[model samples]
Target: MRIKLTYESLDGDIILPKHYNYHIQALIYKTFTPDLATKLHNVGFPLGKRRFKLFTFSRILEKGIPTKDNEKLIFKRKITIYFSSPIEDIVGNLAERSFKEREFKLCNKKIYISQLEIVTTPKIENKVIIKALSPITIYSTLYKKDGEKIVHYYKPIDKEFSKLIEKNAKKKYHLLYGKDAEQMSLEIKPLKFSVQENLKIIKFKDTIIEGYTGIYELLGDPELIYLTYETGLGNKNSAGFGMWEIWRGKESDEDA
Candidate 1:
């Protein structure tokens, strides 16, 4: 399930740090009951030895001007965000709590829920085009001979990019359904992308992340495609990377 949330600032403008993923993440956790919040935070849904949070959210959708030497973003009154999860409890808890509370603090700025609605699921086919709402990231952590840890971020065209994403999605399927899916192949191919324009660098708390934003064609089983829609694509989903929506090519322009 998915939900869209629109927030309006009670103050004249909403000001926030340039890298505010942590703040938004914190706000989402706060919307849950204390016990639920603690469990989701400390111990997520377990599948084998690994635990999955099973939730992902898009980056804030708003126009804002950077100020104070690019340290902060100042937005006029309102912002919108999309959150998704296959787990009904996670999605339901967020919507119910936000509606009941109505008001909350984001980056210490007073704000109220101006709008909240469940987003209808689109018909996901075995093959479809998608555009990233947040950058999709795939990486490997390697330790050097000198005992130095290095994060190697991959471009969408890299072989490991598709391999890792397909692997990740299968794991999600197994975790969600508690059974293995039938053997099938999944492929993600970039459609519209530019290295200079689409490369994104983000800082979440103290960690620097490299990711990419663009349109891509996903070819796979329909079930896996739908799972990707709800749980997001690639890696670091809970930290606000890899949320995407379907793009209907020329139809999108016509609709706009």
Candidate 2:
């Protein structure tokens, strides 16, 4: 489910750092029941053996007038948070806690949540073009001559990245449904992909990781299609990566 969280800046303007996904995750955890929060965070489930996040987010930035302290950033007072998971409690608990607080902290800045509204109309299809609200991050390790390992981050558009998306999708499916990961039948083909130069970099933990946000047309199982959209398509979805929606073509229903 997608939620529009309207926040008023407690202090003049709200300025967030690049790769602000960590901060948003923090807000949800603060409002969660201690036990539930621990489960999602630790993720002892099977898919989590490799540590996959089950949620993604839309950018939480609003253009604002620049202030002297931070001339580079505009004052932003609003943001939208998106949550997609098979577990009802994960979604329900966060929604309840957010409503209760009504006002809370984000990125060390205090803000009041004036409004919370659902913004999702789910449509599922076997083959659909999905648009990313958050960047899709794919990671692979590069082996050097000396047998050292180097991790490389990739956008979904890369030729070899489809396997990464497919593997992650199956992992998530198995993790949630308790299906055999090796036997699951799933296909994800990248029909089309668009890339932006610098907007996809994410700050994960301490490192600056780059990713891409755009439209991708992928063909797969109907259940997988919806799950891909819900659980997010790529890495760090729980930290705001690979969140998507079904792409309705330019023609409206009336036009169609």
Candidate 3:
């Protein structure tokens, strides 16, 4: 089976640290038939006594811009896995079962299995691809009310912020040639939020970048507010993806 995973930055404009490296490792530990275990172990998959081959995999870093108050600044990375057997049969009998039997944590963040899709290739290839979507929500601590006990907070989505987000989600540019004109391109959305006040509060929501998700804290600073957006996937390595890539009002006019 051949699997291709693509990660694209949905929003934000910040550059990720070059030293950051995200790692993705599969854990296959469970009671399996001796034959099956041996097959998996031989391929280098580290499945108890079984092994599996590691095919093509890559990590990509991209950029995005936020258009809303709660929009997320993000960076994206996609991983693809190619196996020798049918993805359904392999993932169903082995992958799914293994994940359930063991505890897998990425970047210390608990992962929630999102979706599994089986894709069929053309006759020339005659292959099947199983795509699994998993997401990890990185949470910070935030107080529900002022002076209240600090608790873990996850960003939530709000529909009201859509209009505001749409109006402001644009790539900003400052022209250096001729008359120093300002330029903007592409409307962006928010994917996640981080709590500025409570570092333990983590929030998730599905909304376009132009929408409003609600306010957590107003620390009297315009740039220090917290908001919510869709969460990204994280791996064992320090490298990961984020949604808040660009600032809401800091779009530049430079040509890429």
Name the top TM-score candidate: 1
- Candidate that beats the other on lDDT, 1 or 2, i.e. the better one: 1
Q: Model 3, stretches more than 4 Å misplaced?
A: 2-22, 27-89, 98-103, 125-256
1-256 per-residue lDDT for model 1 (tens digits): 9999999987799998888888889999998888889998899877777777889998888867899699999889998899999999899999999999999999888899989989989998899999888889989889999999999999998999999899889999988887786595578999888767788888998899988888889999999988989998978888888888888676442211
- Candidate 3 has a TM-score of 0.26
Global Cα lDDT for candidate 1 = 0.87
Where does the lowest 10-residue lDDT sum fall in candidate 3? 168-177
Pitting candidate 1 against candidate 3, the one with the higher TM-score is 1
Off by over 4 Å in 2: 61-72, 145-147, 181-199, 248-256
Provide TM-scores for the models: 0.94, 0.82, 0.26
Give lDDT: candidate 2, residue 119: 64
What C-alpha lDDT does candidate 2 achieve relative to the native structure? 0.67
List runs of model 1 lying over 4 Å from the truth: 250-256
- How do the residues 18-97 of candidate 2 rate in per-residue lDDT, one tens digit apiece? 45677777877787888877876887354444865466666553544545764234555665556666655667776778
